[model samples]
Target: MNVMAKAEKKISSAFIYFFGSFGGILFGYDIGVMTGALPFLQADWHLENAASLVGWITSAVMFGAIFGGALAGQLSDKFGRRKMILMSAIVFVVFSVLSGVSPDMGEASAYYLIIVRMLLGLAVGAASALVPAYMSEMAPAKARGRLSGLNQTMIVSGMLLSYVVDFLLKDLPGEWAWRLMLGLAAVPALILFLGVLRLPESPRFLLRKGDEAQARKVLSYIRKNPAEIDQELASIKETAKEERQANQKTSWSSLFSGKYRYLVIAGVGVAAFQQFQGANAIFYYIPLIVQKATGQAASSNLMWPIVQGVILVVGSLVYMWIADKFNRRTLLMVGGAVMGLSFILPAVINWMMPNMNPMTIVVFLCIYVAFYSFTWAPLTWVLVGEIFPLAIRGRASGLASSFNWIGSWLVGLIFPIMTASMPQEAVFAIFGIICILGVIFVKTCVPETRGHTLEEIEEQGTNHGRVKASNPEN
Candidate 1:
């Protein structure tokens, strides 16, 4: 027992876990910072004429992420997840500093911030994909779910921290509050960079690269006994060989035909709809939306975001309890129904009265957020992970992630323009409609993944997707 303690403590699993999931915190912080920074940024840069570019500035990071995720997969496969994450951390820190201090070039300052943000988006994109793989690779099989769930927890917590920071600094004179809010994201990135230096290369990555000796060493540190270490190493060797052989047969074209086509559509569709259901619309613009609705001066309060951030974090915690306990399809459809109703109520009320209390709209939006956090947000990835064939898991997961980010990018870009042209409730009405479509999509397309092993899902989906595709009405 003493020796086992010594072995585990030598590398410190907690230390490894912290840095492994740290990327989520950075990504979350980046996500929330803009909510506070945007109003001040527009004021500081005098971006009145370039209001059209506001969406670009808000969404440029997501746009850059599309390319970042694509490249990170190939690069990480060749290099390593740890190395690529370190590179991403460096990029986050540098671009964050640049974003905070973007020079005032009149309206072009928006363009400058947009460019900086898009570059930073590269890191955000990489983290979204890499963190899960890194955390999963480092964890033992029995604990994989709990450990991987930490990444999601950290993401929402980071967002909450950013909101708190924005609230604390709301009173600072001039644009300094927003600058500090934007720039401080570098703090976590820097810590992640430093902390990751102590992290060993994942044993799975080592074994894949034919470094069996190093892989054995890492397993010793992470596992309890020789039996556990040897068993895991052998399993990894087998899985790695299967992945190599499978990679040879899989390609982008494979996802277009056979059972792969139907599965990919379902997987990618759920991923895309998770974002398109209008979660980020609320996440990124809660404060601004509240102020616009309530006629509350921006300078007077930035508190609504803090409230929503709490709901997101709390809701994520609740998801952890119910994650493996329920049918994912049921939870998602129910969430969609509730979310659609939440948005529709506010939209209808405002359309009829046009003078309803702004707080009432805020309440319905919160309800939308509460359901979204546990259901589609986390379950999309859970279902995606479960539905793919073992050989194609890596590729399919990447594809789904890309679709997710693209959906988020489109929503972020379009929501502001949507609200500007229509009444706020009208915009909510559109999102509500999308939420309803999400429910139908799940009912018709997504498979129930509860109580099924990965092999079972793939085996069933192999013929099922083909039959469903052929019959159409089925």
Candidate 2:
């Protein structure tokens, strides 16, 4: 707590936190870049009428991410969280260039981009799986939410940056604009790769591998009181020993068995709902949505994403501020209700007045995005990082992440088709129902994890015959 000690902690915290969650920026960039790029892509390909191919191209990253998350999760467990992230960043930078050149494939460029994006998605999915677990392990429990929430903050900031880049490049020839938007992600990916090079391995992972000296050394930079560093190490060692003695299996199937089952369900279900609630339909295709609703010109479409992106960035900042101060379940339930209502009211207005101004739909969707930014967008990862037992944290995080991508893939692929066959509001109404169900899932399954250590959460899970007392009985 001395002034110089405080200065050192601040510097160390900044380094670890920024590099630790920097992967989120790459992931968010892909999300926002596509929103703007899609319109320009249509301009070059003249695929304005080919909805299926466009949907496939848009959904490709989420499709690849499904396997990437599951694979990286298990691999990070065996190899180490930091190593997998480094590998993923390298892959992301390389594929980003390949994605930029897809326009060279002539008529087949759409399919080519799809193939490249699926490959690039491996890196995106891996980052999604790795960042949360890495951040969780590095952060102390009392401040874990704020630190881990930094991942979401970085993600939205990336999205906002992509929007600005897309706007800047919009006046370029159609093919070149989209190409640069896709390729520009390489710069940030390279920065992440360099930043991570200086980071020490997770202290917990080091101890598990029997490198106590290195683990203590890394913990020293993170903790001011030498005794506090030793205290956490001893607690971590004790928890690992108890789990080993109790014969808890880290096998993939073990997630569904006995004690780990309930926690896995809660963690993975939240991850799934975060996507299935259908936020990506807006993130991926907002420009097209605005055009169809209001008869807005294609040239004017890129501006809308900036407006929405700003809301998301601001909302994430708000979440970081209140993250440690509020209960997780309270924020999730309230946010979900508002998000569901945002979708429902728009649909209802469209139903009641077929001639309703298209701007009204745009407004409601923005409202949905605003609520999601503060709630499920950030909190889902927070829970995914916290709820799993250490023995299977990596594997479980992978499972949760894969489910998340699966929902995202489905929403991205089908939203265009659904809108073609039905009213936009009608499609959104279905998403509204999904959001409400997500609120109920939070009420039933998730336990409050605030103000508790990972070891304490594990021991509490042990004491309960089924779930913690905080989780209500069925």
Best by TM-score: 1
Residues 214-273 of candidate 1 have per-residue lDDT tens digits of: 788877767889999889999998988898899998887887667777678889899989
TM match of model 1 to true structure: 0.95
Compared with the true structure, all predictions reach lDDT values of 0.84, 0.86
lDDT of 2 by residue, 1-474 (tens): 477555534448679888999999998998788998889888888888788988999999999988888888778868999999999999999999999978565668888999999999999988877887788778886666677667888888899989889989989998799899999999999999999987878988898899998788788877778888989999889976865754454577877766677778889999999999999999989988988887786646888889889999999989888887888899999999999999999888877888888889889998998999998998898777778888877567777877889999989999988988888888999999999999999998777777777777766555552554346563
Q: Which candidate number would show the highest lDDT if scored against the true structure? A: 2
Candidate 1 residue 136 C-alpha distance from true site, Å:
1.1
Q: State the weakest 10-residue window (summed lDDT) of model 2.
A: 465-474
